[model samples]
Target: MHGLVLAALAVLVSLTAAASLNAATIGKANSTNCVMLIGGEIVQGDFEKFVTIGKLLLPGDDGESTRRNTVCLASSGGSLSEGVKFAKYFYDNGIGTVIDDGQECYSACAIMFMMGTATGAEVSFANRKLHVGGKLGFHRPYLRISPGESIDSSAMQIAYDAAFSSALDLIAVANSKSPWSSQPMMKSDLVQRMLQHVGNDMFMIDTVDKVGRWDIEVFGSSEPSLLSEEQAFYACENSLQWQNGLTKGDITYSNVSDGPNGKRRSQSLSKETRQAVYQVEGLASGYAMESCVISRKKGTIFGCGIDEYSDARLGQGDCDHSNFADRSSSLKAISVFNPATKLEDLRTGQAVVAVQSGAARCFVIKGSQITDNEPCLVIHVGDAKVRGRASTITHFVWPSGSKTVLVQSGTSFEINGVSTGKRTVAERGDCYLNSATLNDFCVLTSPN
Candidate 1:
């Protein structure tokens, strides 16, 4: 299993040959009008490279037509910061950038799709791997089934049809010009088109979270949530419309919300489950060896190493040794993000990396990528629990013999009286402390 996981990690977050174009020499403007900036090298000052490309693509002479033909970008996302700058530059300037060639753009390059165009200009994607991910843990809602668990025929039929059509429509829309207008597409056709046209260029929507267009706005989030119904459906295994309207295998936000039976009180995962999610996926190292791979600075929480921190101390660097924190739905299937939040800002449910331990310890921004050497996120999808028909996790912790707790941070817990400092109960995975628990609070547990 370890080997298999490592192998999978290798394939998912590959370290591409780093390359970038020489800075635009500062003074030479190309007459070709539209500049083709091929990120041939792994970009160090990635955004600057895109800015160079942007220079040639200003608004037209009349401020209407594109000043330059267009900027053609080719390369994987080496620097998310740089990629965002490039994308924003194009969007702000009202010019469309193209991802072309056999180049695979991952990471921040996925933002290439975030252009706010009125006409919904043709965002062509071909033979590119837009694998976007970040280090962010996820919260899988509690799920369970009783002895006579079953679905009603009529309800089940409605669910099945909704699911089938939703799947078809989603595929058609993603692949077709306007998915809504294309009606529905066959599963095979959708996959074929995605593989053919998108190749590895665009994101390969895998987990149920990403099935929905809205669930996942960015790659890394605290709790990887299904932004949309599509994401929720596909995320479940053999999804079924239970008698309660909740999919059998799917976990809902309500399950993680404040309730008698939900994850609002504590870390829903058990020790084994936590360990399972945190299992090392792979190992990566840089050839740059002049400086020790591990470096410790005063006031930092942990020693910094190239494995998780950038060898080149260009800016603040990706990983902050003083603080190490990460959250990933890929490893744990928990993506928690808000659409309004910028990639620069971190929000709840998003896994974080920060100073291991220190008064000033804080979660900082570390580019999201499993193979990038930085600490990667391991998603843990907790077992499902059902209530009324909708399934949710029952992560309540109670004292020896007591009830009544609080729902804090969206975790469910059982307490005797008013108690503080709660933790995961034990292996069976029930966190009970029997304190004067009122509102369910989210619980923290040891990481794998």
Candidate 2:
């Protein structure tokens, strides 16, 4: 059995060329000491390199008395075969993995990181700590498409699908042994999204939410970086629905209060089954509410729905809803946004002020992308302070989270009781006025 498996692994490894794999001990086990594996574009010989490095760094002769081994990785993924081989080796050695601060482990490297946990090959979570400031990205198994080669054939298509399935399975296995049930391995939807949106470009796990989904224990000083407010706002706006009879822009000053279960709490939700719903009110058209369902594994918004009516409230179906918009039922008005608009075309270094629902937000414009066919952006919300000049002003506030007011461009407002004309800011207060109101209710600030 062992020989057959080795033979199969060898055959897979032979599919690629020579690879670069480097290893060295950086510290001791009690000190969280680890063997650092640095590689570029995994290849065939890489497996052998791990074998030699494993002996030098974590010798088998050490027996049970030896300190638990930890491995740190900085790689951009190479051969899938080599990646699998190395992951199994790490598991067999009961080795832990780390993506140190300021480092990156993308593609196959991320696989190694995922597998170096209690579930894949390691015994427990005693020494494994995925520090912040490092990047871990995933995409589909990369394959070269020869020039002028058509993949239209059914046989070729089958082969391609098989390869993708195998790749996803490998990733799933890596994440299967998470220490926390709240954080499990990769999910099918997440893998599909990677294949769709990420493509050749890396889908970086930049947020704490994203990292937490993978169940990789984080150890760092930085808070989870806030993603583009524009994207969040867009999600909130498009997700709204007038369920028992509500129209868009018919009213303002809505209040979205998440229920007791919706409020942020100490207990973490299961990555697979986690959900929350907001109870909306204060609208001219009676009561309205929106619910956002997220995939904890990917830390992404999957499906969102809203109900507008005096009696609109969450049903059992709303809490455990699909990530995609529910448009099948005609009883309620629903708008589903899939593969959100790509924000790559948006110019950076600009500011955009947008209002939706009943809240206002100002974003330091960066760019956007359609993640998993969902629109996404990279932006920063401003505070009430003079920073720089103002630019674009989008009218409308989508009521979801907190309410902030944004003033029109070329408008001045007081900050700390002082008048400022050339700054853009996001003030902490609610500004409610009918559509006829073209007033500057919030101060603006610059990016300086």
TM-score of 2: 0.43
- State candidate 1's TM-score: 0.23
Please write out the lDDT profile of model 2 over residues 376-409, one tens digit for every residue: 1222344433356563323222112122333333
Give the per-residue lDDT digits (tens) of candidate 1, residues 191-287. Answer: 3433343222443433333322322323322332112211221122111111012123323222122335432211111133112111110012223
What TM-score, computed on C-alpha atoms, does each candidate reach? 0.23, 0.43
> Each candidate: what lDDT?
0.29, 0.41
Instruction: Name the lDDT value of residue 93 in candidate 2.
Output: 53
**Error at 164, model 2, angstroms:** 6.5
Look at candidate 1 and tell me the lDDT of residue 209: 35
lDDT of 1 at 248: 32
Candidate 2 runs further than 4 Å off:
1-33, 59-68, 118-123, 126-128, 145-172, 179-184, 223-448
